[model samples]
Target: MKLGRLNHIGVATPSIADSIRYYREVMGATEITEPFDLPEQGVKVCFVSTPGETGVNEALHSALNGTQIELIEPLNSESPIAGFLAKNPAGGQHHLCYEVPDIAAARAWFEGLGKRILGSTRIGAHGTPIFFLHPKDMMGQLTEIMETPKAGH
Candidate 1:
């Protein structure tokens, strides 16, 4: 049940293109990954990396492992994010993802604590196992638990 890091903040967006523009122009984000579609998840997603500690050192940047903004747009009307956007047409923060050392152990630990797990663990956008914690159990913030990505990922 050991926690690794706050991986990313999930942002439900009606349009990935517009979101990317906002991140770049308004938030000063310069490290956004290209948007890609995940048909299984029914969402188009991208990662926007925040500028790390004030330094020009690439090595230090890697070490810092700055959290990312995971912009998510529905791939179709039936997508979960589409539902979220129904309530928030402008779109907004959806969930917070935290990395766990072991996905199974983390799930069990959460269950033992009476925290509802939203669904079965599955491969996530990061290419690692991940699951969601129910918003009702987390004071209304839907939370995501992800298995730490392997060393080279």
Candidate 2:
């Protein structure tokens, strides 16, 4: 049940393209991944990498480096985040992902403490097994628990 590093910050967006442009033009983000669709999750996904974290040495960190921003857009009306987009219109931060050494152990620990799990563990954007803790049980914020990524991933 050991928690690893903060993996990423999930953001719901009306359009990944627009989000990418803003991140690049407004924030000077230079490392953005090409947007891809995850039909199984009903969303288009892209990652925005951040550098220049305070007190952090870039040479010491790997590719995952600082926490990333996951820009997510509904791929269809059935997308899980569609309702969020409808309410937000402008979209906003969606969830926070944290890495865990073992998905099963983390899940069991949370369950033992009476926290509600959102769904069955599934493959996440990072290609690692992940599960969500219900917002109601996690301080009104959806929290994603993901398996720690392998080196050089």
Per-model TM-score, in order, reads: 0.90, 0.91
Off by over 4 Å in 1: 54-64
Where model 2 places Cα greater than 4 Å from the true spot, the runs are: 52-64
For each predicted model, how many residue pairs clash, with residues at least 3 apart or on different chains?
0, 0
lDDT per residue as tens, model 1, 1-153: 665678899999999999999989998889999999999999999999976666659766664577899999999999999999999999999999998889999999999999999878889999999999999999899999999899877
Model 2: per-residue lDDT, tens digit, 1-153?
665788899999999999999999999999999999888889999999897455656654652576899999999889988999999999999999999888999999999999999879999888889999999998899999999888876
What TM-score would candidate 1 get against the native? 0.90
Global lDDT for candidate 1?
A: 0.91
lDDT of each: 0.91, 0.90
True-structure Cα RMSD, model 1 = 2.9
